[model samples]
Target: MNKDSLNTDYLWFLIIKSLIMKNVDLIFNEKQESTLFGYVMKETENKDKIWFWVTIAMTFFIMLLFALPTIIIDPYFHYHEPLTDYGYTFYRQRYSNDGIVRHFDYDAYIVGTSMTENFKASEASEIFGYNFIKVPYSGGYYKELDHLIKRSFSSDNDIKMVIRCLDYTLLARDKDAEHEEKDTLHPQFKAPEYMVNANPFDDIKYVLNKTILFNETYSTYLNIRNEVPTTNFDSYSNWCSAFTFGRETVLGEYTHTDDVQPEKEFTQDDYEMIKGNVEQNVIATINEHPDTTFYLFFSPYSICYWDTAHSNGTVKWNIEAERTAIELLLECPNAKLYSFTNDFDLTCNLDNYKDQVHYGEWVNSDILVRMKNGENMLTKENYKEYLDEIEEFYSNYDYSTFAVGNEEQ
Candidate 1:
């Protein structure tokens, strides 16, 4: 037990003692020494002592019972690899990605937000000839994704390639901006510090957490006891099948308004924010690992998104920020940048998207094939042309007349 547990036990003992001896006044003690009152007092005090010990014992037993699974099973694999006899699941990417990156055997990893979740490890392994792991942090910021990559490189294994998607919509935000809590009302879903850092002292939260203990640790143990199969690595975080994909489904979720959108000019602060985002989160990692090839691609958002940006008057600066990131990334010899913005047929069709930005699973597979074939690659010579073409196509497109027929689903 730690100091906190000891102090709690001591305080509990004192409270129990005080409650048991409250009536044993010193004024009558001398006269009632041999009386029935003294006998009752002695018996009552002895019983209280027994009860206190029992309470303390029960407290420790319960604490041990609650915390033992988290330590032994370790669903997150925080300390070590999964035990050979036990089955493990690879869901909960935010909680388990750190442990997976540190302990898993892989030479390459795909890192990004939910946009990269559908990319299969098996497909990458076949295409790249290196053991691949897909670690996606849905609704993640650049800092945490970069931290995960650094951890992977710092591990005992040698990382050869990093395939990641750079979401164009996230280009203009502050470098330190985190949507971990602001995205939802509940904040308990944020990443744990104990798992993120190497400090063992702060692990108390993780060890004693009800969510990790029950939802993860005990669930895994139950799965093993019941002889249930572990989750497949390829389909671990693939959520494409859970929802329908079509033009109606996509545009239904797409909210367009004629109300005046927030139109703020991109200031010097905006420039610095995006520059720091690219320099610190994206470029710094590439510069450090020249031997490891970084396959960076911009996730293709639907043209409706581009039109909304234009209506909001952010299309110009948004393009500038993404363009700036592309220029900076291309400067690194280890980095290979790809863009799908010029694929007007894909972006213009709402039937290809389940939402305004998220594409179907086929798109994920298609992206891999395209990258492997060197199609639509952004070189120093052609990147300018790609940018100008996308700018013109997006800025001049008539979104109202765009067809929404069932084409790609």
Candidate 2:
């Protein structure tokens, strides 16, 4: 370790390395004249040389190692997770060996935003007596739902019903709201004309989020743990039970919990865009599927938040939007509004909500009860019965005023 001794040792190492390098250099020069080396050098000069090709292959292999599992394996195992549970960027359509999308042979499909995504298809099937599958995307803007409906049905003929969810907040006509509407695997598969005709900006954002950068930057394992298989009512019940209170046997396909909360404040633009998109799309869907039965529901929010915060403007905007949607639905002849706004006495109750807008366990069940009863509204007393079974589940809820009629809650 002494400096003089180290110097001597380093000198000897350098001498050995130099000798090795000189020998290698001599071999390289000799090989330069050999036929194999000449051919290799020429190949390297060409764009399709084995070395260049191999690099490209290795690069793609590395990308596949990271990207494929994130898109295919994770979603495959976690498809049952609510659409709202995962961020919008995670939507993907996996390809089969024959390049076809492998979908559940559902006789019915739920087409809406995240609100409808959390709904268990099995539960819908149980209520309607038809196999249900969810074809949901984030934001569930009306136009997007229409496109997805077209895509899902066009892909299969056995599809019978389209279950769509409407929300008051989803009706804002914010011009600045940003939406992603791309089909990342479009190049690999034959997509519907609507996809090909979508806005270019939305398309780029979707491709970037789903394929290029989203998975690589986000935590996948965390997401998978939250999503699971929802093939039947019992399985859905089990999934929801795991995240809810007490030991209970799951009897349905959806987990009963009020965990998801949308904490981000809406931008002025988001308000306008959402409202505009929903209005336009609802009208379009009604026109296109004139014979299809459209069941629309404005999903319930936490009573405490809505009562304490939502104002008259918000209520008016939402109600007007719903009326507009209803007008469009009327055009379809078979469409009907199962407006939870009027049915759930607590539809405007913000305290029963888990967050600014999400409802509690008991509240969600009531909505399920309403969904189960397509033609009749659940009386306030009946909704109270489910609350009674849960034993003051909303007792600790924040006592806030939601100005749904005149002022902000």
Candidate 3:
């Protein structure tokens, strides 16, 4: 065909297709209008009474079939056990309980990743004469820690003490793009939407579906219910087991499986930065509530993993961190290091660790004992001893055979 003739034909085809699409839309609209008119006429003839009742019945049926099951079944299938537990409480409160609002008057808080979850607030309260709450959210790093400290310490509730079981990697300041991309991933870590300073739009998905999606709302309720009940020390250990193994089986998600070894000491500048944060943020937080007495700790791990970290140059960082942490406490005049790591015999047990770093609730009970006996209650002699042990641990296990601020042999 000639080029001019082919161009004309294509133009004609485009015009024809546009007209056909318009005609099809017009026909569909007309059919919809006719169907609506018929329904309206029928309803008018019946005085609209029958139609109203039928509509109500259908609506109720749909809610019962769809909404109820979404509130109940979907979370179980999704392996959101925590969500299920919260939903269960919410339903019970909404339907059955007297509907009392849960209030916060906590005197103590247990803060950390899953490693800290086993410590029961009640036990801490009983031991320390302070009411305790576990703000246990796994994957919470230093940024989250800063937020929680600011929010909780500043609240009306007089927080008497903060027992922090910090993960060692929290010192890593390499920020990921996910920190901005996935804000909705951790609501507990973020400031509340209603707060003027916090941008609610940051967690758009949570505000939308977490609030509007009625099914997911039920899961939140279950999470609240699960939190109220205090599991025994043994139950806490079993829960750790579930967290370690059951999570993989149920959700096919890994938690705290990463192996880390500290290989190099942070420079004096880095050491100062970390120390400054712990002092300004962590220690200053306790000081905000004059009534509160802080006891800081580093949780115990297996000797093998501990040794590996020590060999990897973790010992120097750990010592510097702890030393700075102590200096910050000294500034407080009332604060102390409840030194579980300083006194424990890590060489005795491989059974202590569930993995590279975390362990079960057995340590929680031991901690309670240590706190009670004042074994962890720091003295100058004991403080010197703790520093000595760090050096000894490094000398014995450190593979690089290097010292902080010293050249390799």
Candidate 4:
């Protein structure tokens, strides 16, 4: 592929005929091969020159064979859309998410951390009157999600709405440095840069990758022959089927600590940090694409989670930060803000969740209906009252019953 070197196709011809020329009686019957062999061997006497051309020819041919499958199958959807007739497995989130974002067909998408994995794309699409895809990063940061969304807009898809969750705890993090692109919960997996950016020089990381070769390319071949399982693109990353939801299950996952985590109130500095985080990562995208409506919600962490934060002294701090975030979002005419973080029926009931933050598929279904029906939506007028109501609910909720030894807790 390097333009500076000898042209590869020309060399292959020289290579085969020159080998046969060693015994001339070994000819494989071809005018083309004979013609090319004459062009390279013509007026050439040095033995070293012929071998040099043969080696270069073999190198390029081997390289081409190794890279061809990745280019055609494109396991990551890096180069093209999934061949419509090809079946694929969509289990690896970090590896396939970028390709889905760029090449998958959709007018709307759900983007968030693990808190969002239960959302059913088909249900959301039906309610919103748009095709929806889910792009969830279990422990994703604002900067990373924003980068992926920006790529969506850069593509030719006519995006309609962007549904994203505003994680309350993340509102207080450092404006620019609090991301875990590599140091995530699953540190072994991280989205590679060659696929994320437009650079082609580093594309060797993708074109010759082993995962793409054995797992993706070979797996696709198996699918075509009905020898392997395939996934529906719509239900790609939904994990609601993997866990049961109930008070016992939710509490079983939590380990009660007596450390009496020190409490800190939200300060002016914290508000500034929240502002900087959104303005740069979220609002900038909203401002850039006014035609694309943004459905922004503060994901509801269960009451047990709030109680833990309350004991640690940061419940009110998170509430105020979320309120500030809502205020900023409401100013964007195309943005709709929902404050589900305080929905008592959902947040107070541990049966709706698998853990402190992740809710059941039914809860995700309920949220979609609420968003469709405009319930829990914050207006410039009622956000103050609604936020206060949630603050009091979470800040004072009883969490003793959620202690360890509780079933599924």
Per-candidate clashes, comma-separated = 0, 42, 12, 10
**Once superposed on the true structure, which residue ranges of model 3 sit more than 4 Å away at CA?**
1-103, 171-207, 210-212, 219-238, 243-266, 344-347, 397-409
Candidate 3 per-residue lDDT over residues 256-336, each given as its tens digit: 222445467657776667776665556666666666666666666544445556545566766666665665565665566
Per-residue lDDT value at 374 in model 3: 74
lDDT of 1 at 321: 78
Evaluation by TM-score, superior candidate among 3 and 4: 4
Residue range 1-409, candidate 1, lDDT tens digits: 6786566546544654564456334322524767544455565757566556655865665566567778988888887777777778767776788888888888998999989988888998898799998898887888878888888886888889999889877777778776563212126455566787878888888888866665567668767788967665579789888878767777677555544366557778877888899899889989999999999999999877886786787776777777788878889999999989789888877767888788887888889889999998999999888888887887667655433442223
**Local distance difference test, each candidate:** 0.78, 0.45, 0.50, 0.76
Could you estimate the TM-score for every candidate? 0.80, 0.51, 0.58, 0.85
Best by TM-score: 4
TM-score of 3: 0.58
| Model 2 C-alpha lDDT per residue in residues 296-407, reported as the tens digit of each score | 6767554433333232223333434444444444445555555554434564343443344544445444555676666443333343343242223333333332212323
The lowest-lDDT stretch of 10 consecutive residues in candidate 2 is: 93-102
Ten residues in sequence with the least summed lDDT for candidate 4: 24-33
The best-first sequence of candidates by TM-score reads 4, 1, 3, 2
Which portions of model 2 show Cα errors greater than 4 Å? 1-102, 135-138, 174-177, 180-279, 302-314, 348-351, 361-365, 376-409
Per-residue lDDT, model 3, residue 309, is 61
lDDT of 4 by residue, 47-120 (tens): 47776776687677556666787789887788777886677777666677788888888899999888788788
